[model samples]
Target: MDVQLRQLRAFVAVVDEGTFTDAAILLGVSQAAVSRSVAALETTLGTRLLDRSNQRVTLTGAGGRIVTRARRVLDEVDRLERIAQEARPELRVGYAYAALGKHTRHLMKAWAVAHPAVPLMFVQSNTPTAGLSEGIADIAVIRRTLADERFDMASVGCEARYAAVDTEHPLARRRSVRLEQLTRYTVAIDKRSGTTTPELWPATMRPQTRTVDGVDEWLTVIAGGQAIGVTAEATANQNPRPGVAYRLVTDAPRIDVRLAWWRDDPPPCLDTLLAMIRELYSAAPPGLPRQRVPMVVPPRARGRH
Candidate 1:
């Protein structure tokens, strides 16, 4: 009954940043404010939240559950407020090449017909650079990859991986391929620094690695018979060069088209964007995956429970 937005905000900050001091810095508030907010939140919920000792803070069992729900609620509230302030305008969405797959044409056509009045702004983004980290997209249809925690994400769908080689290449005849098998060939990937590569590639197949600037450039190398490459079905669809083809890599994670917001509290322009994105992703054909951590196991306990 006495719950407050500040309490929720404070708790989420600590859970994400891992320290009262860090949360306070991010909120531009005193550490005391953070500690007080968390304490008050625990009292209101009738649960002990943190176990702090040894100068290291840890979340209790209940803290994990509470923080998860609090993040969702706070995020929605933020988005709602922004939506209220800004009159509906055309939604702008940012995405890398792989996010908009072969079916993008179909999706756009249907979206236009359904919400023609709402202008749709789509920008093609190449490479996963500071643009996404700095909050450049409302919904970023990125490659089959897990976005960093810094971004609010909604999975579009999985992008199946394909192996592209010259027509006369030995492995071209096979319906599928693996990373281990491609070790001998030259490999190309959109190297996303700071993100986990193993999560993207489940199978252990290492090829001579190379990074390309854009999809077209990547296609050129593939078409020239200079290198073998792995790409999502969407990338293959978007850049259909004559000499290249992609098939199941066996190890590719299901790529997802995610709706992202810089902060949990999104801007109003973001709401329309999110709404439109949600509508699009909801009806998306199978193969896209959203984030689902099986169980958020908190760090080891330190202070009293």
Candidate 2:
């Protein structure tokens, strides 16, 4: 049947208000218009929806069933409209691991104050490029270099490295551990999305590698003493596992924090986001050991394979 959203709204309003006159007042239209809308809805559904022989209008048996369904339809239409309105001019940023690490709250609050007109959303995905490659995000916070030449990236900050081990593991007793010390244990790595790789270690001293899919799995395996995990300081800050202890990886290379977007159609606020993130990292507490660095990818090197 050709039922319109307006007709459903009118039907719901009439039922809620208990009279066509009241519904017309709520809808800001004449009583005749409200009556006509309800009539059209009943005609389209091919059913008697209301009995209006007396001053008090009442629903027929079919009207009760149809009103319930019509109200749901109208409510859903209202929700759809609201979603469209709210999503317009909104920004969705994706991340696979620690989202800005310790600076997440500061970044969000600052963004809200700086761009009150735009809504910022953080979407989490476990894929290598967060959700960027899947078209689920406008930009992504990535820890590793994106292999795709279609993307342009900027390094906003760098985080120190940490080694995650079980609380009961011998290495956990130490305040910090060297990369070579971790080589003695099996290393749990999320090869697809993680920044750590066997190449981080000297070829002869490479630890036996165990594959993991995501941060949760890596933590679980590490906590169970199945393997040790090497990750950026952000992961340790964001995920403090009860059974897992994170020790500084004193000898490992720092992890670069990069913001990436599709080069051909970069978001308008890309530059602003990068600048704000750089500021947040730069202003971070010195104890966190955050390093503020200029964009590592040169203008000439951007968008290049």
Candidate 3:
């Protein structure tokens, strides 16, 4: 009932070293202490573990069986400790959809060079906060503003909105389409994780909507010509489907790409990541306009309506 790790270690040490004195020296403890620890272990198990009647210390039959299992337990405990110590070094960034779009690879390469000691990992989770709320990620790249009070986020960049339509659809022939034109089709949206919502349209002009769980489903539905999808321009660049065509939504507001983390105890590299991303967006090529929105928002005012 009351077993301790030290007791197990002491028993195994005495068995391997062939004597209590040698085991005590290996453990940096007194011989009497090692003897007491082994005795306590045997008492707890209600069995005699060591045959002290012999000149050379030997194990009882029960002790031999238990020792093998005890050694395995000790080894697992050591492994767990090592994992816990190494766990904090890696940074995991979660995303619901296109993670920073075309900038993802460039940002990863830059971080590798800038912080070689700390590794970067990307996780995809189709929840609204990516994996932040689920505790699977230290930071998340989300398309919309997160209104949760527990998180702090920054607008790292913005991208033009685009409509995804079937390749054979009439609108696919046009170079771009306005928000009003999209209202004519049934729009597919991922209500849980998607940035596009019915609220984006005026009350009376709102398009009929269909719900999909993730990006792939949305693309599939759009490709089937039963619905159309409105998403960040990055989605077009990141996920190009053969049956789907992406067209610019010239009248819709640009989608904001945000980086978010828990506010109370943010990762140590948060500020560095923010700066690196800000620089990446600022250095975008001539044609792409870089819009720098102020990063911080008041805690209580954070979630999507």
Candidate 4:
């Protein structure tokens, strides 16, 4: 009944990476350490979690049933640790790629003027929840809608899509590019936190893909001229890398920016924070300049599409 967090992490990593060697590499540990941790986890749970017969590792029925619960436990532990490490009272806003794009600093200054007592801070986490679920941030700025009912969300604004290309690439010379136009090239994507996916294109027109883990890697691949990337406009504003250029994706749909927090345990000054965000968004509707954001609209009331 005694289980360690490291054991759970090792089991989860192996399940995620499909090989012990890869899991070790991810965790910055040796392969023997990963194997020992998994073994210890299985012993503690009194269940065989993995099938290691083939070149790739797979989950047993028990593992399939337990992985989700394990993830929840880890997330809760992480949240607890974050709460314990707090140095002061401040609003921690999380984002995966770009935090509010060009609106980030304006929002911070506005919050400072309104809530002078509590500082507003932005943190980056390359996860789907942008560090919200991981307990790294008090709230999250997410491009994609959260389906989890435990959290409540409101749309703050929408941003146009852009194509990231190498400076030497032909697409870099164009003012804008169409979705179909990039189909002939390989697309670099972050499946975990990135908004763009192969699903965005028609099945027949979908381009070859190279998977990257984060914004830095995505930019590197694109800068190498081996691949291109599609992302929200905020990336262009916040992450202008050398040898990489961003052009508008004229045919792509705009990405909605939303603020999400725990529904049952809303943060302090929640209403004030939400109002400030909406005010900012309304003032500038993506392409406009210095427009106030609108009133709060709940996630349930709006469809992602």
Candidate 5:
């Protein structure tokens, strides 16, 4: 059976308004149009929906059962319309965790100066796509690879990796830490959206991992000293918790920060956004490699030396 959304809307509207005249007024359609819509709906459903008696409209057994479902359907249709409306002018950039970190404000200010009418907003969604796939955002800041062919991605920048350790942890005293040094401790990782993974280290050297769903949980676990966390510099810059010290992961590869959008339906101002990001990254990028402190040997190795 062909079920039209308008027909469902008309049916629900009639039920809500008590009279066909009121329903027509609410829908901004003529009473005749409202009557015809309701008639067509009943005809399509192959059942009498309403009892029109004494200029009053009341529900039949079938109508009573169907009215609730029709309201639900109309509600869903309204939601779908809202979703379509969201794709208009404003740009919503979603991120699974900490957005551009220290650069977030800079980018916002730059975008505002460039495109004052179209607002640039950041939304946090702890999903792999950030929120692109879920329709919660028009663009996404994805740290890891999003293998979906449905979306196109641009490599905007890269962030250095940082080790999150409790202040009391011995490694926290160091200016920087290495992957090998962290191997002895359990690492907290958000497998879905986090940039770090066990694969960063060789199979033999990989640390025991504790899985977390989001950044808050990861930080809590690290602050509690249950596990150490290795994350993008963005996390360190934005999320500094008490008792949690962030140290640069000197030898680990940097996390590639990328912007992703639907391949078929990229957002407006995308080029401007990309250009601003490139300029920001190019102007004041991550620290130079030469600045990295040499890895300090652990106490065990230092004792032998």
Candidate 6:
């Protein structure tokens, strides 16, 4: 008999328990079966695995080596099983840089409970809303998006855009200010996540520009009155930066939060997750514009030759 897994199990159990009878009880096998397995293993390995005399059962040098190797083999087998179990019912979800806030974290936990069967896999990407179109993700939560003929778009929520400014700013006294009123102030944004190029170049105001990796840094600058910024409402509430205040941007585009999936036949649970998400977070719809990547028409089609 070649060195086998069963033999190793029996050998380890007997060594661990210090007796064949105890090992048999632990393994739920007869004592004679346990003893036979160990003896077989010793013969196959050509090494005495244990020192046994009278009532004493101890490991030999060879036995010590086998046990060390055996434990590793068992551990690897267990790991493979766990990985296999996690691979089922998986969802590849993506979020944009700005959208990766407390809402995502909170919604993730709620989503987990709502759909215990789905294995969610999320990635933060620049193309947050286009994930479904690019075939990189099953779903995406995005802001500044619009209806896509290729997609069945509906508002999951929205985030009110806050005019971030210092406590001492001239406009800070009022509860709110129209976006156009801040034309004179510098505006920083996550330009990467924006839909337009130079993105601020298309704007009415040529405000000073500052590109940030995320919202936290923008908050700091806003608090210092160096530059004003816009943030999702959920973010503003998380930590209203010290010496800083936020208020609605009047006539400003509210960030539209949407749950977008492929217009094609989606997984059954996708529908369920969407329903639960709406039910749970239906209150306080994130205030923001619903934006989308529009399919561009060819120049040939646009000109009336």
Give the Cα lDDT of each candidate: 0.66, 0.86, 0.87, 0.88, 0.88, 0.68
Which candidate achieves the best TM-score against the true structure?
3
Candidate 2: tens digits of C-alpha lDDT, residues 1-305: 89988788778888788899999999999999989988998899899888988786889999998888887787788899899886678788999878888888788898999998877888999998899989988999999978899999999998888888888788877778898898889999898889899999999999999999999999999989899999988888888877888888888888889999998989868889999999988877523433222233557988989
Q: What is the TM-score ranking, best to worst?
A: 3, 2, 5, 4, 6, 1
lDDT tens string, model 1, 98-171? 54665666667766887787656566666463245545544555544454676666554454666767655667
List CA RMSD, all candidates.
22.7, 12.6, 12.0, 20.8, 8.2, 13.5
Q: Where is the poorest 10-residue window by lDDT in model 2?
A: 286-295
Candidate 4 residue pairs in backbone clash = 278-293, 279-293, 281-293, 282-292, 282-293, 283-291, 283-292, 283-293, 284-291
- Preferred candidate (TM-score higher): 2 or 4: 2
Q: In model 4, which regions exceed 4 Å deviation?
A: 1-87, 285-305
TM-score, candidate number 5: 0.68
Model 6 / residue 62 / CA error / Å: 14
Tens-place lDDT per residue, model 5, 16-97, is 8889899989999998988888899989999999998857789999999999888888788789989998755689999988
- Candidates 5 and 6, the one with greater lDDT: 5
Off by over 4 Å in 1: 1-88, 129-137, 144-150, 193-205, 264-305
> Model 4, range 138-190, lDDT digits (tens) per residue?
99998985799989998877889989888877777677789999999999989
Instruction: Provide the lowest-lDDT 10-residue window in model 6.
Output: 287-296
- How many clashes does the backbone of model 3 have? 3
Better of 1 and 3 by TM-score: 3
Model 6: how far residue 259 lies from native, Å: 5.0
TM-score of each: 0.53, 0.68, 0.74, 0.65, 0.68, 0.56
Give candidate 6's error at residue 267 in angstroms. 10
The residue-by-residue lDDT of candidate 3 on 163-218, one tens digit each, is 88887787877778898998989999899889899999999899999999999999
lDDT of 1 at 231: 66
